[model samples]
Target: MPQPSKLHTRFVRQLLPLLVLAFVLSAASTTWFTHRSQLAQAQVQRSQTLVTLGAALVKPLWDCDGTTIQAVVQAMTDQPNVRSVLVQDQCNATTWQAGTQAQGPDLHTLTIPLLYYASTGRSYSVGALTITFTGVSVRTSLTHNVGLQLVVFATMLAAVLTGAAWVFRRIIGRPLHRLREAMRAHQELTPIPAHWAEELAEITATYNTQVQELRRQARHDPLTGLGNRTLLEEHLQRAIRRAERTRALGHVLLLDLDRFKPVNDTYGHAAGDAVLKTVAQRLLSCVRDTDTVARLGGDEFVVLTPDAPVEGSIQALAQRLRNAIEQPIDWNGRALQVRASIGVAQLLRDGTTSAALLASADAAMYAHKQQDR
Candidate 1:
């Protein structure tokens, strides 16, 4: 029996980590790009506002218009991204300042020189205007949208992964699981459903083929391809039950090779194996389709005939098996021959049980061998 496959378990274990990593990567990438774009846009807007405010104050400063200068500065302070605004005199000293302190977290300072243009196209520096822009404003706005984006991404990822998991289980995981269970239970596995995908169908087909081959190897003789003792016993038990039910006579014929050791000792085990295979083929030919032919290890064989007619039929069957075994076999351009001594035991006459019938047949076969000696 084969052990269960961990296809689903291993797939989940591996897929989950990869999906989490992908989600993390996607989220980070989206957030990073969004933040950078928003920050750049914010920087541009702040630059434009600073230039416009500087233009508005140039005339007020040049004419020494204190009321206008204060009014313009106050309006600039009221804008949301601007933390503070300050005006400096020609000496670079702060003349007027509004809003919070110039120094603060997530704030940037920009200074522009005030120039007075004359009729001759000559410019003179009047003073400078300094404005502090709050960098946190862009990030603050991003926070809400980022949350929504993350939620959307998460939902999409979950749906995709769920579909993928279902597809994987339907095509690969479930079929492999079924095959594993059938193998573990030592049961004949039905072929995978035709509706399954081609790859899974191919896999199950290959699996079933190998399983059948393994079963054949287990119950059969490797050399002769005949049913081995295990298979023989199984058939024998069934035959015994059937005979008991029908109240019919059955026969067990045990055949042991005479002069088989000489063939092995003189010609090596290879020739002896060839002789055995040939004999197995011969034995199969001599029996009816309902009968069973099995090899019980080296140079020994058993033929089971259930619902046999009479004593004469058993004798005729035994003679036919002996004749088949005595035929010349061609191996390696050499003719090799062997003989079999067959002993028959009648079911319900010699013994009722499989063990008893086999025992009786085995004993009778040895007696036949002794008589030939």
Candidate 2:
């Protein structure tokens, strides 16, 4: 029962894990490279320090100065990270040794040959000096560096997630909420505001088109392309409400085609359809743009006039409608004449409710038809 539309669920289940994995892998790789580089630098520094020490001890071992050799070894051990140092003589005998030996895998050793200049002016190896470093300081520095890197990585990950959430709310969450509201209210779909992502914009555009077509199909007649009975009732109710608010009178006219059956029977259904279409156009031409003309059903139509003037105005509009319907329509090279019986009713005068007003108008139309017969 998980809703994919929920932003928090999507972020946690999908995006959060992906981002975390990527950050972990990147941080791990960076830490590994840093560790190797730090170890290499420590080794190079240790070797350089040992070579310098061995050179200084060469003169001491050659002169057999035990005090100087011991002093030098002690001083070398005193330097940071130096674990142990040993100096030997030409006979390969240990001359001086200082500091305790490191016993862990982190220990590193380097040995350098001690050379002396003989009286003959030729340099020869007199002894060897061995040095050992525990690498404790190096490991500490590496750990500190890794801890700093983790802090920076965490900060960057937080920033990326924050930006992503804002983008999701703007592009996905907000638009979806608006769409849901429009659906619940049964209103026309409003076009989504401009978005940074093109795919999202396209999706919004497609949704707008679909909703418009759905509304069109729901409210319009398929045959004459006019508003159907349902649309007429909705418009009538709205007009009644508006008239009540403005204290303006309104009118309703129901029209029934007088000879519509004869046209269908004598000329076939095709001619009947053409006649209906023609009558729809004529009705549209007779009224103002503010008025609503609707086809209730077969050969039956209704017109709603909001803010209508006096009774004289209503009668004049009805006469115009009858005249429009009586006009001859040319159908496939044949002149066909049709008449309509119209009933007029005034808003607030005839009735208040839509059903009551419609019944009154319908009765008036039937009375007019009987008189014509």
Candidate 3:
């Protein structure tokens, strides 16, 4: 099966016919207008030519000078549109005429009155001049003008189509293509660059935010807002590598809350949740910023110090953690208290890997809890 077409391709395909139709309508309207204008211009030109020629022929027609009248009529009839010219005296008899009869059926005739002024300051009608104009000249001019205008319209239409394609690709197609590729590759965030366009920017931002939230939820405990076992293992592995490289002493502490199940059994899980939140905050306050605190599960917590200094001993750190857990948590006007049993394991001395270290710390933590019992 063939692959589906892209968005821009589809858009162009859908819009092409409409653009072509519009071009055809525009060309037709322009040609019609040009034809009308050419006809009107021909009429104006014929009127002007007749007025000028009649003024020159007034004296000749009055004196019956056949030579001058014939010369003037022949001159005006020589024009391309003037098919024939006729001059008639006051008796309606032809004084002089030039050219043949109308060649085409479409023809126009205009007659102008020739007046002469005598020595007595009185003017009288001498004769009339009639000229016949052919429509062939106007038709030829309309055809040439319409052809030229069609070429111009075609050029402009091509330019508009090219510009439309460019705009669609830049503004709509590129961003969506990038988004499709990233999604296919299982990307965590959108890879599209800034300053491109706002069409898909909001969608990319929303997807990236959701991805970050999913990552955070995967590696953190929802109840206590502390690192989960997955995150703790990652931190431990990194700390183990650092300790092995620097040849420094590091410590891991495993802690278990004493009598924690009784609180959950008595006051319900809500009270137990409050107690766990309080414990998490106290653990954070007790440990250094360089230390990692994680909740492995119900009432079980672990702390990893990647770089334990010589001044701070493992026993002191464990004691501090134990004391912090022993503090009272306020819940509904009641002070709930619990004790913690912590076990310490020195990196490189007890175990090397995260699993081994955690096992060692767990065994020690159980032994200490039994002693408290």
Candidate 3 lDDT, tens digit per residue, 1-373? 9999977788878888887787677767776777688778888888898888889899878788778877988898888778899888764366678887765557888898888888999989988889888873545655776677678768876887799889878877777787777667757554657866775888887777777887788889999999999999999999899888997788899999997888888888899999999999999988888889999999999989997744567888888888888888888887888889888888988899998999999999999988988
Off by over 4 Å in 2: 2-5, 65-88, 91-109, 118-124, 132-145, 170-172, 188-217, 234-250, 265-269, 306-320, 332-337
Residue-level lDDT of model 1, residues 1-373, one tens digit each, is 9787676667778778887788677766776777778788888888898889999988888877777888888888998778899997553344977888867667888898889898899997878899999874546655746788678768876897788889988777777788779879876567568878788677778778888898899999999999998899899888888888897778899999988898899899999988998898888887788889999987889999987844467788888888888889898988888899888898878887778998999999999988998
Q: Name the weakest run of 10 consecutive residues (lDDT summed) in model 1.
A: 136-145
The regions of model 3 sitting more than 4 angstroms off are: 1-7, 10-43, 52-78, 82-89, 92-109, 116-126, 132-146, 157-212, 309-311
Per-residue lDDT of model 2, residues 309-355, tens digit only: 44368888899889999999999999988999998888878988788
- Colliding pairs, model 3: none
- Residue 39, model 3: lDDT of 77
TM-score against native, each model = 0.74, 0.75, 0.73
The global C-alpha lDDT for each of the candidates, from Candidate 1 onward, is 0.84, 0.83, 0.84
lDDT of 3: 0.84
